[model samples]
Target: MATQNARKQDPQEALIDDLRDVLADTEAMIDDVTAQGGEKALALRGKIADNLRAVRSRLYDAEQKVAGKAKEAARATDTYVHDHPWQSVGVAAGVGFLLGLLVSRR
Candidate 1:
C-alpha cells in the first residue's frame, strides 16, 4: 500500500525535466552574452534565433510522430478488442489471476 502510494519518476518525465533545465540554462547564457556588443551581437542573436526555430520545428515533428504511433496502437487495440471480446476478457482474467497470485505470495 505504501509502495503503491509513492510517487514514481518516469524516465520520459525525467528526460523532459532535464531538457527544460538545459534550455533554460542556455537561454540565460545567451542573454548574458548578447548584452555587451553591437553588430556581432546582433548577428549572433539572429543565428541563435534561427537555430532555435529549427530545433522547435524538429521537436514538433517528433512529437507528432510519437502521437501518431500511439494513436495507431490504440486503434489496433480497439479493433482487436472489438473482434474478440471473449478472448480479451479471458486473457485479462488470466493476467489478473497471475498478478494476484504473485502479490499474495509477496
Candidate 2:
C-alpha cells in the first residue's frame, strides 16, 4: 500500500510543484539582481514583481477552487456510499476484480 501510494503521481500536483519551484527560483533571481543600480532594471523588476503577484493570486484562487470541488465530491461520494452501502460495495468489488484480472494478464 505504501509503495503503491508513492508510485502514482498526480499530474496536476506535479505541475503545481514545478510551478512553485520556478516561481521560487525567479523570485530569488530577482532579489539577487536587485543590488545593481539602473532605472530600467528597477522598472523591470517592479513590473516582474507585479506580474508574479498576479500569478500567485491566480494560482491561489485555482487551488482554492480545486480544493472546494474536491471536498464537495468527497462529501457527495460519502453520502452516496452511506445511502447505498451494498451498491457501493458491489461496485468497488467489481472494479477491484477487473483490475486484478488486467494486472494478472500483464
lDDT of 1 by residue, 46-93 (tens): 787777667666656655666687799999999999999999999999
Give lDDT for model 2.
0.79
For model 1, state the Cα shift of residue 45 in Å.
1.8
- Per-structure clash totals for the candidates: 0, 0
* Model 1 accuracy (lDDT, Cα): 0.72
Candidate 2 C-alpha lDDT tens digits along 1-106: 6335435745555555556766898798688768775887788799889988987887787677768878999999999999999999999999999999999998
In candidate 2, what residue range of length 10 has the lowest lDDT sum?
2-11
Best by TM-score: 2
Residue 82 lDDT (model 2): 100
Off by over 4 Å in 2: 1-22
Candidate 2 colliding pairs: none
